[model samples]
Target chain A: MSERIRDFLRRRDDDGPCVVVDLDIVRDNYETFAKALPDTSVYYAVKANPAPEILSLLESLGSSFDCASVGEIEMVLATGASADRISYGNTIKKERDIAKAHAYGVRLFAVDCPEEVEKIARAAPGSRVFCRVLCDGAGAEWPLSRKFGCDPAMAPDVLEHAHRLGLQAYGVSFHVGSQQANLQAWDFALAMAAGVFQEMAVRGIDLKMVNMGGGFPTRYLKDVPGVPSYGAAIFGSLTKHFGNRLPATIIEPGRGMVGNAGLIEAEVVLISKKSEQDEVRWVYLDIGKFHGLAETMDEAIRYPIRTEKDGAETVPCVLAGPTCDSVDVLYEKTPYPLPVSLSIGDKVLIEATGAYTTTYSSVGFNGFAPLASYVI
Target chain B: MSERIRDFLRRRDDDGPCVVVDLDIVRDNYETFAKALPDTSVYYAVKANPAPEILSLLESLGSSFDCASVGEIEMVLATGASADRISYGNTIKKERDIAKAHAYGVRLFAVDCPEEVEKIARAAPGSRVFCRVLCDGAGAEWPLSRKFGCDPAMAPDVLEHAHRLGLQAYGVSFHVGSQQANLQAWDFALAMAAGVFQEMAVRGIDLKMVNMGGGFPTRYLKDVPGVPSYGAAIFGSLTKHFGNRLPATIIEPGRGMVGNAGLIEAEVVLISKKSEQDEVRWVYLDIGKFHGLAETMDEAIRYPIRTEKDGAETVPCVLAGPTCDSVDVLYEKTPYPLPVSLSIGDKVLIEATGAYTTTYSSVGFNGFAPLASYVI
Candidate 1:
């Protein structure tokens, strides 16, 4: 366990689980990304962690924001960040919310379809828009599917329609996926985005921006390469494809920016053998899937667990969240290696939990309070 | 489509999707259960749909409650429901919360462990306690796991320990599992509970209650038998097992009591083919797993879907929630047969969603608001 986590747990007064964020680590992660990609502007995705303090700190660092909804736009504005720094990244939105975001001074919007572009034209009127090119999120831990983005072949026509609607179809964008593992995924998505750019160029429409959507990986159980490696690979791919013709760049980093800075100090509520003959044990924690760790649904993303009972013989155990619902079992499908000596009241530190932890929590699930966060 | 739903769709004022609950149906569902099981006391499980209006209506109907947390207890109290009528049913609870609930006038609690019984013994001394017996939860639509139960073999000793701890070991409880479809599942559970009761009697500890925990099935896509059938099967099993003498019985009904009363009016945000040549279509809705209908996870409990173009040629489509998250795809793993004529602006009615709908919603996930419920 990290010294920061141990100290946080030792000095904790709360009875149950809470996320403790170290702003220093967050600043370091931001600087690492900033130092790596000089030409690219970082638009922190607020959906990952919308804590006001985290936003305030990142706003002070001159970081831009990628908002998904009017509520998120309001949150960013509440952080005293410039409205010009906000980009409505979500393509699926209500017309009223689009107008609201525009009224709130958001000028940049992401669109993938003609209907959405029309809505933007009517609501936001003449705002700069980026059309997302469709690509199956390959080589990512959490692969986003056909919910957003349209065909790259269709993106040119979509952009042309946006231009016809009097909106500035300024760019092309695509997401490799969230927590993209293989660096080649970036090249694949960028290639797709480039195809759209080329097709638009052929149609006498020159796109000015290339929004590289968020997929930057964060370290959890796997040995994720540093942000510099990603920067090198991305920049190399951009140079190979575009040479000196790179467009005004935008990079949205959700998980990669804030994922590594937070740790959850969860107390073990109970430990018992599920069945008398079963080999595995069941370790129940005060926090579970509903309490903000719902990303563990398929064990697609594994959070490394650290126990106070270190150096002891480890055994495979099914970890559960504190809820009456059967589906709240956190690690039954993917059992965790927990110390056999781990008992009730022992603190378990869930590492790299900052990104999708607090924001994803269900409001009062099973009457349990939403996750509490402490930014240090 | 039902007339109530058609009228609701025609009159929706909100720009986003919402859950419209028919209060008449809710009261009828309660009456149905009450009339079917005249001997059994009804305790509505508040965690399923803890809407204050629902609580108030149920309170007016003279219904008791099964609360899992202090928050739920407070909500129930706010509805003018007496605390003595509320049973703290969650086995996993902190000692302080237990004391708080007791101070709020809750005398009944369900526990599955000796540690919990001891905690209750100190916090709510001389209160009624029920020990849940472990079962595999076989033959149910949503089979519950071993999250809140103890081994049947250990129940006698556990109850004896509870008695020794100065707590009243008044009942033995077991869940057939939520949305239980099989009549035999209840018999198996009741038989197990009887064994525990017999053992307790031999130890000179008289047990006077048996909580046939909530599993009562509700109407979804398939035909579910009515409450009368369940009552007949249960009464038959109770007579066959314990002929002359019977305990004061309690049935905690969550889904069965309120599931069929609610219908979610969600707008079809977008419907598009996943790929150019891909045969399957993706239908995106305003609400998804993160929004309110999380039970769609694993498709364990399928909600019957109704579209405006019901008579049109049907095509199979993957239903998804309106979020950037990839896992928000509700029916991709199990696609639904939707109308080919269904358009983007059409509304889909999700039936039997009153229970486990609004309460489990993620607060502002992806910046979308919570599932709004209108009680008619």
Candidate 2:
């Protein structure tokens, strides 16, 4: 445990459910990656946690932003970051937002379809744009690239459309997936990007940038390779796949940059056996899926939990959030191990919650207040 | 179609995603239930959609409120609702919130556990407290009561605890579930409630109220019977189980009260064949689960969709949201039939969306804005 968490918990006995973000840990996570990947430029994905404190720290450390919407652009710009550092990374965008983002001085945008590429050409003339190719994203905790990418065969056509529309078809991008633990997925994706590059080259369009989109793993309940492991694998893949000529590398890391820095301090509201005959215990916490831990929907991300009651006999229990909604249960499909003696008012530290916690909170589900956070 | 919706669509060309709530339809739905259940008091569950406009309308119609937290209580109070008309319906509540709600003059509270009952008894002494017995909530589209109810065997102890703590021990509550379709489910749930009532009676605790928690169905993708049908089934079940000596009845309606009164106008962002060889077509929309259609998770409570190309040849397409997150895909497990010609910029109407749309929107998922609603 860090000194910041210890200090926070000393005062968090009755403060209710809140996220504690340690500045030191966040700084360490950021600097460690920067040290490992000297050849690649890091653009922090803003959708993970847009808290001004996190953005400000990354900004002070000379980090750029990978934005999905105008709100992300504004959030980063408000933190004293340059607008030129922002890339509108969501392929699907409103025409007005495209014009607005361009007006705000954003130069790079992501496009997957011809209509979107044309919209970008019309809304933000001559802006540098990247085409994202479909990634199978196997061996990932969350296969997020499924919703944003187009077919590999269509990449040459997409870049051709971009060139015809008077936009800079500057790059090809693909996400292995969120929390990509397997290093082999990158080798496959990079080799696939090489195919798209060759196809585009045949079409007389030489893409200048190879955008290795965010999928960087964060240590949660499962152990994952450190920043150096990913950096080494990615660099090796780039060299082997591109063969002495690689495009300008752009690596966007969301969870990897911020996931380990924050912890959620949630109070155990009630520890009840659902029924007398039922053996499984249900532990309800003050904070639930709606409040912020929405990523636990299908147990895709198992957040590590710590309690003050250590060395006590532990039992497998279903974790639930404090809400009237049944879907608020965090882990019923996959039962979580918790101390059998866990009771009301006992605090549980949900670790590595810095990335997706606050951003995914429903505005006010069941009238419960949204998750609150503090950067120490 | 109502004139309000027609007028909105006629003028909504190229407009972004928005919810259009029609007051005329809301009033009609309210009056339909009011005419059917003259014996039952209506307490609108504010968690469904806590729009101030909806609250003000319900307030004007002399409808009471079922609140989950102090925030809901304040929202109702801000709408000029008397504290007497509000019930803190959530079984789980923080100590400070219980005290705050009591300070704001709320006197009715729901409890499923002994600790919560005691907390309320201390926070709001002599308050009208209702014990929620465990309900399987079978046969409902959304099985909601599972999270808030105690086992029937434990109901007596909970009510006894409430009585011992100086609470009024006013009622027993159970939900058939949200979007309950079968009337027979009510028969079984009420029979289960009668068991708890009998146990409490044996303990010399006579409950004064019976809360038939929100389960009334709304007209969505599947047609549901009108309010009269539900009222008839409930009345028949009450007479059969409770005999001539019945407690005062309170029906908390969330989806049933507001589901059909609002519709969402969303623009289709992309319609693409998933791949050259793949058979599935993916339709991307501006509005998605994070922006209000969260009930679509697990294919429960599907809202009916409409487009101007009503007569066009339709094909099954995988629906998705505009965000880059893979989970943002609206309907992939269960594909929806959409017009084959539906292209970019075309609008799709998500019908019967008044209940869980705006309140469930993530604050800002993927930098995309939270849902916007307009009263027509």
Highest DockQ scorer: 2
lDDT of each: 0.85, 0.85
lDDT of 1 by residue, B1-376 (tens): 3467668768777677788777788899899888888999999999988888888999999899999889899999999888888999988777788899999999999888777788889889999999988887788877787777888887887789899988899989889888888999989888888888899999999999999988998888889888999999998888877777888888989888778888898888767653366678888888899889899887777888888799899988988888878778788777899999998778788888888888788877877787888777
Off by over 4 Å in 2: A8-15, B8-15, B277-279
Give model 1's TM-score versus the native structure: 0.94
lDDT by residue (A1-376, candidate 2, tens digit) is: 5777879778765566888788888788888878888878889999889889889999999888999888899999999888888989998888888999999999899988787898899999999999988898898888763677788988888889999989998989999988989999999999988998888888898888988988888898779988899889989999999998888988899998888888998988777664567778778898988988999988788998999886799998889988878788888877898887787778898989988888799888887767888888
TM-score of chain A of each: 0.97, 0.97
DockQ, computed on Cα atoms, for candidate 1: 0.53
What would the TM-scores of all predictions be?
0.94, 0.96
**Taking the tens digit of each residue's C-alpha lDDT, what string does model 2 give over B127-218?**
98988877777788777635778788887788898898888888889888778888888889788777778788888999878899888888
- DockQ of the candidate models in sequence: 0.53, 0.61
Which 10-residue span in candidate 1 chain A carries the lowest summed lDDT? Answer: A269-278
